[model samples]
Every structure is written in C-alpha cells, then in structure tokens.
Target: MEPRLTNPAGLLPDVGQAVNILYKSAHTAGVPGSVLELVHLRASQINGCGPCVDHGARAMRKAGETDDRLFAVAVWRETPYFTEPERAALALAEYATRLADRPDAVPDAIWDEAAKHFSEKELAAIVLWIATTNFFNRLNVTTRQQAPANY
Candidate 1:
C-alpha cells in the first residue's frame, strides 16, 4: 500500500527520537532481544499490521532465527518451536494487545505464568516491548505504512 503520509511522526521532530529512546531503554533491560522479536512478531500478526509484521520477521531472521521458529510464531500455542519462556512471553503479548477481548485483560493467570519464567525486570521489558509494538502497529495501520516489499 502507498503511504498516506510522507512522515506522519515527523510533524513533531522529536517523536521518532523519543520512541527510539524508550525502545532503547527497553532493550537494555533484562529480556533478551531475540525473544522480544518474537513478542513483536506475534503482536503485529494479531494486529494485522503488515509493516510491523514484516519488520519483526526480518529482525528475527537477522538475529539468526530459523524459518521453523519464525513460521511458528503465529501459532505458538500449537507449535513445539518455542520454549516455556517464549510461550509465556507470547501469551503476555496476546493478552496485552487484545485487551478488549476479555474483561480482565492480562489476567492473573497469564501474568503469573510469565512471572514463572521471567524476573520482574525481564517482565517489565517484555511488557514495554509489547506496548511499543502495539503503538507502532496502530500508527502504521492508521497511516497505511507499507512493508518495504511483500515477503
């Protein structure tokens, strides 16, 4: 799709930089970058935002993620491709992204499951990444940001 805006975030010069700082801050926290990529891909897939999904997959591939794992991200619950930690993270991403689906979004069960795998700091980072990916998904979908090329 053609972009609806040349530089939607550019209207405010510091927007991109601000987002970058927050993203960088999250990266520096306890969660590994590789796992965060999976969270991003899963969340983007749920949002049906092509640009974020494309970018997330490319990020994973660049980090040496296998095709099997990459393809399994969307159906993580049914696949054997992920570890328990990854599954917990993906679950957190799903519930957080689709908050309106249930009355108690990010219910205690999912949060407790994630807590079983991650430290409080690590959980914070995963959550930040989830929130950030959702933000970008809405922005890209709203502005019709196209993927660099169809994959």
Candidate 2:
C-alpha cells in the first residue's frame, strides 16, 4: 500500500530526533544487539509492519546472525535454535506485544523466566526495546510504510 503521506519523521524533525535519542539509549543499555534485533523482528512480525521486519532482519544479519535462526524466530518454541535467554526474550516480546489479548499483560511467569536469564538492568533494557519497537511498528503500520525494494 502507498503511504498516506511522507514519513512523519521527515515532516517533524524534532519528534524524529527525540525518537532517535530514545532508540539510542536502548542500544547503550547493555543488551546485546543481536537480542534486540530478535525482539524487534518478532514484534514487527506480530504487528505486520513489513518495513520493520525487513530492517530488523537486515540489522540482525549485519550483527552476524544466521538465516536459519532468524527464520525460526516466529516458531521459536518449536525450534532448538535459541538459548534459554533468547527464548525468554522472545517470550517477553510476544507477551508484551499482545497486551490487549490478555488482562495481565506480561504475566509473572514470563517475567520470571526472563528475570532468570537477564540482570535487572538488562531486563529493563529489554522492556524498553520491546516498547520502542512497538511504537515504531504502530507508526509504520498506520502510515503504510513499505520496505524498500532492495530490502
């Protein structure tokens, strides 16, 4: 679908910069770049934001992630490709993204699993990453942002 208009980031430079700053903070929060990409890709897939999914995959690949693991992110539970920590992060991403589907968004069990793997600071970073990706996903989906042809 065609975008409804030019990307809002271009139209509102200040807002775009603010988002960029927030995104940068997440990157420095000590979470691994690879994990963050997985979280971003899973959330984008669930939100059906093609641009994000494309960008996330490319970013993951650039960080040295393999195609098989990236392809199996959607079926993480069925695959033996991920470590326990990765599984926790993916579960957190799914639960957080599907908040409206349940009353207790991000149930304790999921949080507990994640806690077992990530330190408190890393957990906070993961939460922020999930929230940030969701924000971008909603914006892209609403604007009908399409992935570049080369993506």
Candidate 3:
C-alpha cells in the first residue's frame, strides 16, 4: 500500500532524532539486543504495522538471527527457539501493546515474570523499548506505511 503521507518523523526530523535518542538509551540497561528485537517484532506484529515488522525482522536477520527463531517469534509461546528471558520480554511486549484489550493492561504476573528475568534497570529499558516500538507501530499503521518490497 502507498503511505497516506510521509512518515511524520521524516517530515519532522527533530521528532525522528528524539526517537532515535530514546532507542539508543533503551539499550543502556543491558537487556540483550536480541530480546529487544523480539519485543519490537512482536509488538509490530500485534499492531499490524507491516513496515515496522518488516524492518525489525530484516534487521534481526542481517544481524545473523536464524530463520527458525524469526519464524517462531509470532508463536513464541509454543516454540523452543527463545530463551526464558526472551520469552518474558515477548510476553511483556504482547500485554503492553494490547493495553486496551484488558482492564488490567499489564497484569502483575506478567510484570513480575519480566522482573524475575530482568533487573530493575533492565526492566526499565525493556519497557522503554516496548513503548518505543508501540509509538512507531502507531505511526506506521496510521500512515499506512508500506513494507519494503523485498521483505
């Protein structure tokens, strides 16, 4: 599909830069980049943001991720490709991205599981990553941004 408009971040470069800064800082808390990638891909998938999902998966693959893991990401719960920490992060991404689907957006059990897998700092970073992904997902979906032809 053609985009409804240029990416808002592109039209407003400062907004893009601000998001880039947030993304960079989100990596400072020691959560593995792999886990962050999973979070991004899962959230984008949930939001039906084809552009973000395409870009995220391409980035992961370019970084040497295996097809097995990438293919199983959408069905991570039934797959053995991800580690426990990765699973926890994916779960958090799902619950957080679907906040409107439930009254208790992020239930304590999910947060506690993520906490058990990640330190406070790591959890902060993970949440930041999730929030950032959601922001981009909304932007892309709202604009009808198209995925790359090759994706």
Candidate 4:
C-alpha cells in the first residue's frame, strides 16, 4: 500500500513513551526478551501484521533463536522444537490476540499451564506483551505498513 501520512512525528512520541514503559515493565517482570519476541511473532502472525511478523522474527533470530523453531512456530503444536514454556507462552499469546473469539478472557487451565513456567509477575508481563503487540499490530495495519521481504 502507498504511504498515507509521512509525518507521524506529532503522534508517535506519546505512543513511543507508552511502548518504553511496556518494555521496561516486561523486562522487570521477568519475561525474557526471547519469550517476548516469540509471543510477538505469534500474535503478529495471527493478526497478519506484516511489519510485526517480520520485525519480531528478525529480532528473535538476532537474539540467537533457532531457524527451525522459528519456521515451526505457526505449527508449534506439531513441533518439538519449542520448549514447554515457550509452547505454553505461544498458546497464551494466541488466546490473547483472538480474545473476541472466546470473549471470556483466557481460561484458567491455560493460565495454569502458562504459570508453570512463569511467576505471577512474569505472567503479568506476558499479558502486557500480548496487549502491546496487539496494539502495535493494529497501528501498523491501519497505516498499511509493509514489511520488507527480507526484514
């Protein structure tokens, strides 16, 4: 899609501040950068947000995530590449992103499974991570931000 408005400077600063807070909180809450990236990629995939899918995947790779696991993330249920914690996180991300489909919030069973790998604080971070990515996805999609093929 063609670029609509090139001057985002006026609006982005405030949004950037919120993003900064989210990042700091996520790190402080004990969510690993890698796990955050995985959740980002998964949520982006579900939303079909190209920029996030591309950026998240690349960030994960740069952080030393395996290509095999990255490629299998969409089909994670069938793949043995992800650890149990990662799998649980991915499942949680999916539910969070597709919340309208469930409307009841994430189930306690899924929460319990994810909690096996995360402390309460970490779980809070995961929720924020998902929420932030969803916001990012909507923004990028609304702007029609395209992901570079190799990004």
lDDT of 3 by residue, 1-151 (tens): 6899989889996997899899888987799999999999999999999888899999999999999999999999998899989999999999999999999999999999999999999999999999999999999899999897873
What TM-score would every model get versus the actual structure?
0.94, 0.95, 0.96, 0.91
Per-residue lDDT for 20-91 in model 4, tens only?
A: 898789878877788888998999999998878988888888889899989988999998898899999999
The stretch of ten residues in a row with the least summed lDDT in candidate 1 is 6-15
lDDT value, residue 104 of candidate 2: 98
- Cα lDDT of all candidates, in order? 0.89, 0.90, 0.93, 0.86
Instruction: Kindly report which residue stretches of model 1 are placed more than 4 angstroms away from their true locations once superposed.
Output: none
Residue pairs in collision within model 3:
none
Candidate 3 regions exceeding 4 Å error are none
Model 4: ten consecutive residues of lowest lDDT: 3-12
Model 2 regions lying over 4 Å from their true place: none
Distance from true position, residue 6, model 3, in Å? 0.7
Give the distance in Å from residue 147's predicted Cα in candidate 1 to where it truly belongs: 0.1
Worst 10 residues of 2 by lDDT: 4-13
lDDT digits (tens) for residues 1-151 of candidate 1: 6889864676778888989987997898878888899899999999999888988898889889999999989889898889999999999999999999989988999999999999998898899999999988998888888888645
Who wins the lDDT comparison? 3
The whole-model C-alpha lDDT of candidate 4 against the native structure comes to 0.86
Better candidate number, 2 or 4, judged by lDDT: 2
Report residue 82 deviation for candidate 4 (angstroms).
0.8
Per-model C-alpha RMSD: 1.4, 1.1, 1.1, 1.9
> Model 2: per-residue lDDT, tens digit, 1-151?
7999777777887978888887888888888888888899999999999989999888888888999998999999999999999999999999999999999998999999999999898898889999999998898889998999983
**Residue 92 CA displacement from its true place in model 1, Å:** 0.2
Highest TM-score: give the candidate number.
3
